[model samples]
Target: MKKILMQLKDYYGEYLLLIALAIVIGLIVGVVDAYFGMILLKITEIRSLSPFLWIPFLPLVGLFIVFMYQKYGKTSSQGMGLIFEVGQGENKVIPFRLIPFIIGGTWLTHLFGGSAGREGVAVQIGATVAHTLGNKLNLMKFQTLLIVIGMAAGFAGLFQTPIAATFFALEVMIAGKFIYPALIPALVASFVASTTSHFLGLEKFQVYLAEPFDFSLFHFLLLAIVGIIFGVVGSLFAKSLSILKSKMAMWFKNPYRRVFIIACGLSVLLLLLYQGRYAGLGTNLITASFSGQHIYSYDFILKLIFTVCTLAVGFQGGEVTPLFSIGATLGVVLANILHLPVTLFAALGYAAVFGSATNTLLAPILIGCEVFGFEHFPSFFIVCAFAYFFNFNQSIYGKQQILK
Candidate 1:
């Protein structure tokens, strides 16, 4: 035991510097995320009259995105692929040039009413920071680990889910195998980042639920059914996005050109459908879930469609946030049909669907515990596990190869 303790101590110190660096990187990422969100909200106000007014010219926004990418962002096109490359021992550092491209591109995409999420942009920024720092400092393998930890910190800071964020950084690449060694550093960075962001007045997503209801056999059975449905939906969303992206890529030799045309076309369609409700980050859908308001039974379906189109067309953003909105809405509708509490179902749906889509079991379970409290752990674990299995190893990141 003493030998084991001593070895652990040595290993812990090895990562101490990396953890500290991740915390600092996380702080910057948090600020950027918050500022970006504020800017998007302001833009939404400017275009608030109606989506209809913007529909006719919406494709122009996509053209502008393409123009910017062609002019300045050719190298950063890989996004998450770049991160995975770096993780797997590639020397390709995300150049500082990408920071501006992502920031500008993402801002433009959202300002013009593209349906997307912000976390992916933030993660790339965070990883870029870590990459730059590692290169400048001449750090070795351990520094690469720090970069991954920085990713978790950025995610935790943005979403305010420290535990989930820690696991997410480790879980995102593949299924089954947990990166146990990185857990401590990831957790430390995530918690510090989340705390710092909270101190800076970043609000976490809040959901109101009544006391733990009795979990009868019937409730478990219903929850399992919800898990299966969510799994199917999640799988479909991922597959659709992959297929669309591939087809678009095949049709256009240049990715940038393809993205521009597709984005513009989708924007126009969105404008025609123009409820002014499904645009931007779709946070309103999340709010509606908590409030027990009636949502379009097909709200999840529409969001899935729009999000896939937006992302497939090269709008940089994370898929998780939109997944949350879609899952919560789906849950609410499902709950109503099953005569269950909307709040409960919505919460379960949110985590389980995400878990299934990402092929992450424990991350979503921890997310549920962190966001909705530990009392829901049993249901969360069961539902998320079922969802994970039902999804059959599908994921939004199609390149990810699951070892376990």
Candidate 2:
């Protein structure tokens, strides 16, 4: 390694330092993600043991969560918005405290049966850790790059999809721009984080799916149609989230009252409807969509409404998993109507809807190939491309900047 570096006069120890930092950051975030995922799953399992016992207290939990944030959260409560502000250079500092605040808040949300996702927490965890490291090490010039690196590691650590994570972090800050220099560090961090989390016993969700029929012009056109449907649904989910967040804040005014009142209602609705079926990541819907476990036509719509409501009312979590659930369930219903194989269409939805909702093109396509199988790459590409085109540039991240 030293010999190679010596051969290039222009390049010296900077590359080595960057690589070392990426590896260190990845290792640290990977350990954090592994514990975060495990604790969350354990709490969710415990809650499922007696949802009636646990779920009724959602309003109280909501109050506690709000109080915790109000007391110790400070600017951390801005959540992903703070990360974005730093990424876009509008703000510079991401406090050291965001990591615990997000993780603890999300764990409590899941434990109390709030309908939410985990990816947002994962991304924020990564960004905060990496950004803190950069700040301490005086890597001010690469501050934005560190945020991207941390985001990739956090996502990869949680989902075990390094390729998709790298692209997601790279493309997420801007609609049509890429941070070219962060590519190597980001990739290194992602793979290391993914490997570390897997080694620590966090499981990655995967399914094997293939093209239902021979590829033909008819199939291609049909895929385009399906993609549009998923796109519209994804757009609706993103738009509704923004609207609900704004409207709820306007109406309630007080954070404590808002969370408590809404959570009381959500607890009853979540309990009454299928006994906590739409709560905590919507993995039930996703599993049912794939496993043929009696998914109703309204499953997607209800999950969408429940998740948007949960987040809008101050619950903590991410949106990507619920988006995945929505896509998968919607795909199941649509496939039945279109007379196509449910597995194939559901897989398409799992990826395409996420892409559409996040306004990310490559990440979803790559995630499809990674989580499902690369053999379905063409199908994923076709569906994800169409979905991206029809997304109308809506994103669950309120602070995302569209280059176009």
Worst 10 residues of 2 by lDDT: 7-16
Give the Å error, residue 249, model 2. Answer: 0.9
Task: Give the lowest summed-lDDT range of ten residues in model 1.
Answer: 49-58
TM-score of 2: 0.97
TM-score of 1: 0.91
Q: What overall lDDT, based on C-alpha atoms, would model 2 receive against the true structure?
A: 0.92
Question: 1-404 in candidate 1: lDDT tens per residue?
Answer: 99999998987777786677676776776676666655755666665566666544556767776777767777787777777677656655777777778778777776677888877776777677777777777775665576677678777877789889988888776566766666777788788778877777767885656756678898788778888998888888778888988887889888667766776667666766645567777777888888856688988999888988888877766788888889999998998898887888899989988887777888888888888888888888878878888987888876566885
How accurate locally, in lDDT, is each candidate? Answer: 0.77, 0.92
